[model samples]
Target: MSLDTAALVTKLTEILGPSGIIAETAAMGAYLNEPRKRFHVPALAVVLPKSVAEVQALARFAFENGTPLIPQGGNTGLVGAQVPLKGNEVIVSLARLNGLREINADAGHMTVEAGMILEEAHKIAEAEGAMFPLWIASQGSARIGGVLSSNAGGVNVLAYGNARELCLGVEAVLADGRLYNGLNALKKDNTGYDLKDLLIGAEGTLGIITAATLKLFPLPAGYETAIVNLSSPEKALELFYAMRERAGTRLNAFELVPWIGLDIQTRHGMLDKDPTAGPSPWYALVEVSQPKGAEGGLLQAGLEAAFEANLIDNAVVAESLADRTRMWAFREQMSECQSREGASIKHDVSVPIAAIPRLIAEGSAAAQALVAGIRPVPFGHMGDGNIHFNFSPPVGADDKAFMAGAEPMHDAVYEVVLKLGGSVSAEHGIGQLKTELLKRVKDPVALEMMRAIKQALDPKDILNPGKMLS
Candidate 1:
């Protein structure tokens, strides 16, 4: 039998004390308000579980009562996975479970509780002469569980890889209140079906990630960074291949930015000074890591070669740490800078690496055809083939009307992406936002496999219900 709302709240409070439960609406804002502010469904209560045992207990209770449980960490997700969909679900937050279980510098691995913030993990790694390569813009507020759950990919994915690649193993609590202890430091295991992989990007539908063993690497001596001018995405691609051949694995990042990004930032006075060398249709931010015994200037040499080949127009190499930071700030602030322009329609999609140029070209034309004066701002990880294809409404257009027309704009861009053999979601996984799209776009057999896994792991559909799967 289903319990009444009052009984459920009272039982949750009884199990986790008054401090652990957030029952008041005003106090629940921190948990309810996700990063995008798109999902506004109110949760029944927010439960702060401080330990693995607490998490297991909470899971068991929710499973037995047939109440939906949304596993949340940091609440910094762009997708609505960490927030409630149905109004009656309870949010089980892992923030209070923050703990650093162990760090082995020699072994190059750190076992950390899921609640630890991503930036804090970086600090711990730095202290040990190691580096954790997974980076996102919201690292300060994003926790390890949410990062691993979403399989986040940041700018450095060109060199290191995404969260799935960085994680060695994970420990999670299953829907039936059973703990799946899979954490280990092993680099290679030819064993079974890779359950850790399943839970890592499952978005909490299969299990609640409690802790993880993450791979680490020796800290680079420094970075050779530069921002180069490119006439088009095709030129950027040529330059990327040249740098890859020269730097090999040292090529850390290759990010593409359109001129509109520079214009918006400068017009809004968001930057102290222009970070680019001069005017160009597009800019490519490139970086190569220098090991302890290795020399720098690899980026400069590559850029010089590109210029000689007529692939790039000009470049500005960062001479000091401050210059490097400022150049990175310009790239990292792309998403936030769009807000100053007006209402924006954004899509995170990826094509084959070679098809990036075509994807951008075709996508831009389609979006422009739909809205006469729309400004296409296609930018992001060119090396990884992922583009943050965004469009700013015409100058002085009504925000309401422009936003109301977002559906056609989205359809236009997605159609192009689909034609290019690209994903509807590149880095950001499907939350409630794209569940329907996933059903329509994903392969039928693949969808069946996903459904079977969801049923086997979470039969009652109590964990993060209506997330990755519709």
Candidate 2:
């Protein structure tokens, strides 16, 4: 039997104290309004826990009472993972636990509480003359817990890897308020079943991550940034291979942007000046980092080779920090600029690195065929095969009507993605939004394993109950 709403609020307040609970619906806006603004369900209450012990207590209370708990941090997720799926669930925000526990700049690792903001983590690393290279647009407000939960991939993933790769170990709170003390910086540990891996991308369905040991690296001397103009995705792929062959791990980022992105940014006056070399069908924002005492001009030499190989036509290498900032501003503004045009149907999917060109060409064609004149705005980390395959509705199209037809458009685009052996959900894990899609595309055996693991970890089904396994 479900507890009365007032009773649930009272119980949570008793557990967390008055300052820790937000039971009023009107004041719950900040926690419920996620980045995408797609999920707006009212939660029973938003609970803020100050420490791991508090989180464990709340978890135990929720488990015993059969109250669903939604683990959240910063609320900056693109998917609906950080927000409430069922109105009866209680949200456990980990913002109050932001604190860095340990740092070993020479040993190349740091221990930080999950609620530390991503930007703050970067600052802590820089203070020690080290670096933690996860660069996403939401880093300013995105917390460490959500970043690890979603296994976020950003621009620098080409060199350092995603959150899962960057993380060494984690300290989490299990369903029955059991504390999991797994934090360590050991480079090698052939221990049992890798619980860290299991919890990293589980989307809060298994446990609440409290603290984590993240891998750090020596700070690079500087970065060589360039924006190259390409005729198509195929040529961009060629240029990418060329850069990877030359720079190897030094090639930090190779992002693909469409001509429509440029058009929209220019129309809205989002950039002070054009960042690309000239008008082209496509562009690649390629970057390479120069380590301490390493040779400079590596990116220029690589670009020169690409020009000779007929892979690139024109390029603009950043001569100053301001120039690099403007170029990145153009690439980062791709998502926000889409809203200015009108409604956009989006898919964050990934294919093999080599199959990226085909995925874009075929996916664009499929989306266009579905909604005639649909502006295809497919772009993103081409180096990693993940593309934000989004479509801007045709000119003068009603936003609601266009959105209403989104289901068919998504089906058409996903068909192409799966045919190319790509993933339907790449960096963003399945929250409430893609549970049905996960059911249809995921392998049956894999789904069964996921369900088994979910059951093993959370038997009472009180943790994000309807999400990911919907």
Identify the candidate with maximal lDDT: 2
* Model 2 C-alpha lDDT per residue in residues 289-310, reported as the tens digit of each score: 9999999999999999999989
- Root-mean-square deviation per candidate: 0.9, 0.8
Model 1 ranges with Cα > 4 A deviation = none
lDDT of 1 at 373: 89
Return the lDDT, model 1, position 185. Answer: 91
Which residue runs does candidate 2 get wrong by more than 4 Å? Answer: none
Expressed as tens digits, the lDDT of each residue in 212-330 for candidate 1 is 99999999999999999999999999999999999999998999999999999999998897889999999999999999998777788888888899999999999999899899999
